[model samples]
Target: MADLIEKILSIEGGALAITRDTAAKLVNNLVQNGEVKPEEAQPLIDELVARGEAERDALREDLAAQVTTLQNTTQSIQTMLNANIKEAPERAIHELVLLGEQITNVQDRLREAEKQVEENTRQTLGQAQKQLRIAQARLVQATEEIRTGSIDEA
Candidate 1:
């Protein structure tokens, strides 16, 4: 209610005090501009800053978990590779066969998409050309009418 928020702006903590104060100032502007109501100011600021911090913390945790999972998976893959060292050549051949098949599939899909796009472009071009012809005919008819009218008046 009073102006004591400035004094206790960092009540959340030190580092986030700046974050909190900055958010409060921005939201306060919305209140001043009538975009946000005066009574809703403090709650809005608190909710926004808290939500941002929670999101940041959650992201950090998620990233750490993902990194750990990746490291574990890579280690497992290395162990498997070591154990299957004798079959490396066979595995390489099989993987190459699969990769080649995948490449062919992608190429076929890309060709189909390109053909569809070309057909669409051709249809659109035909429609545009037809419209242009119609417009030209109208223009010629209008010119002929104007010329005939001028000669009759003369």
Candidate 2:
């Protein structure tokens, strides 16, 4: 009988298992075992049943509180997700706009670099042509002096 009581009481989360019927049955078994007499059975049964009811009520309250807390947390998370979902498009657009501006800047810099390269190439070609012309004129003057009597007199 003591062992039975201990086993029932020692169970973890036993409030869900301990009902009025189970309490009465246990008390009846204790009476049959002569641990409790027939006259004492009713009071013991009532007390055990009441204790089970109290435990059940307490468990029900705790479960209700936990359910409410879970619902509130779920609502909060849903609201946050909804807000993020709403803002996702805006964020993407903002990022794309920034990327477009950066691309345009890069294109402009590339154009400027190309223009500078072309100008430098043109200037280099012009300088080379001028130098060639000067060298050709000097060579012609030397040829004329050699062909005429100026070379013999010098």
Q: Considering every candidate listed, which one attains the maximal TM-score?
A: 2
Model 2 RMSD vs true structure: 3.5
lDDT of each: 0.76, 0.80
Lowest-sum lDDT 10-residue window in model 1: 1-10
The TM-scores, one per candidate, come to 0.41, 0.77
Clashing pairs in 2: none
Candidate 1 regions exceeding 4 Å error are 1-83, 150-154
- Please, what are the lDDT tens digits per residue for candidate 1 over residues 4-29? 33333445342244466677887787
lDDT of 2 by residue, 35-145 (tens): 878887776666656666787899899999999999999999999999999999999999999999999999999999999999999999999999999999978888898
Give model 1 RMSD, 1 decimal: 31.2
**Which candidate number would show the highest lDDT if scored against the true structure?**
2
Backbone clashes in model 2: 0
Candidate 1 total steric clashes = 0
Model 2 residue runs over 4 Å out of place are 1-33, 149-154
